[model samples]
Target: MYQLAPNIELLFTEAGDYHDRVRAAAAAGFSSVEMWGPTGVDAPSTPKDLPALKAALEETGTTLEAQLAEPRTQFMIPPWDHSEFFRKLDEGVEIARELGTPRIVVGSGTGFGGWKRQVQLDKLIEIYQKAIAQIDGSGVTLVLEPVNVRVDHPGSLLDRTSEAVYVARGVDSPSFGVLYDIYHSAVEGEDMRAELAGAGDLIRYVQLADAPGRGEPGAGSIDWVERLGWLRASGYDGPIGLEYYPTIESAASVRHIVEVAARA
Candidate 1:
């Protein structure tokens, strides 16, 4: 059986502090937890917060697997000048390094303008190329994710899974890989297993969130249990992320998500 981490971002809205959230996650029997944003969710998690988060992980034996840069806060843009993009990316690398986590989820912001769209493509590539080089010694990897434009994110600049993978390879670094999100990919109308296998050695992370209702694991038709089997069949034993919008209480939704995965 694989270890599943309950995402606390959607859980425990009643907690007042950041550490309270981690503590709740630990109490929930989750082996790991993930959250978005460095601040404004409560206190800004700085280099200082890492030790408390670390202690919570230690006390609970839970891993802090990943962190989101909060939507539209940092990085994630098309056609940004190389200097500006790399600067933000470097900051992300620093966050990952300080937290002792290996991966940070990268979002593609809404499309850019002024220059031809094609020029933005080249700039995006250049940003990745330059920034990834800086993290060579840091051991932090960037995982680019594609979001759906139809239901969840309509104006998302990156829609196709193939395009995201292409950009990942275009970045051409050992650490640069795509975070293959089945939910958004499914929303865009693609065979999840086929696309995942197509990624082969390049797929670094796999996250799950269902469609239609977009609730906990079995509340929708994502077939998470079977999909998990696909990941196993394909030889991926790494962390599987639960990035869903909760239709029920966050903690209750987590219980249900865990139950579904367990039954699977």
Candidate 2:
């Protein structure tokens, strides 16, 4: 059976506060939750109460599956100084350690206008190589996520699963891998089954929202049952994060997909 982790940042909004959302998720029968960043001070900041968030997790026995290393600056693109990026990463690592979160998500910022794609890819590998060094022995894994450009992220540097896999292979560290967001992949018209097959163990994490609408599973065009079943059959036994907007009540919205995932 697959483990379900609700993205507290999006789901459980009825609870109002981030900490309360953790309790809400736990009450609704979810054992784990994920979030964007700790401080919530990133672009389009969510500024959470870290103390309360931590207490909620401890009290509810809810595990923090992962969190995004926020403010996705131009770290992966050209003129790649990555100085501030590393500093933020250090802070994020400290927070992750405090929260007992084992994984942190990262993004490939927009591509440089003047640089070739190959050069950008090389720079990403170099940057992540340094990133791995920075977080070495932190016991936290870094998951590189690829966002879709066709709709959501217009100028994102990395939009393909193949490219993410390539970069992860280049990094070649046990502590670094890819986060395959099914919603983004489907939005970009990717062949999900083939990509998952190709990703294998390099896929360190997975997030899902329905395609076309970025809503709950039944709200979009993709086949949740078939696709989720494929993920299970492919041996990806990691936590499957629910990262979507609810068309109805959060708890009610997730019931079917949770059942589908359970069967998968």
Best by lDDT: 2
Q: Write the per-residue lDDT of candidate 2 for residues 53-167, one digit (tens) a residue.
A: 8999999999999988865656634555668889999999999998989999987888566789988887788888999999999999999999999988998999999999999
Full-model lDDT, candidate 1: 0.69
Q: Which of the numbered candidates is closest to the native, going by highest TM-score?
A: 2
Worst 10 residues of 2 by lDDT: 71-80
Which 10 consecutive residues of model 1 have the lowest summed lDDT? 39-48
Model 1, range 82-154, lDDT digits (tens) per residue?
A: 4554555567667666666678777666655555655655656666677678778888777888889998778
Residue pairs with clashing backbones, model 1: none
Clashing pairs in 2: 40-47
Name the lDDT of candidate 2.
0.89
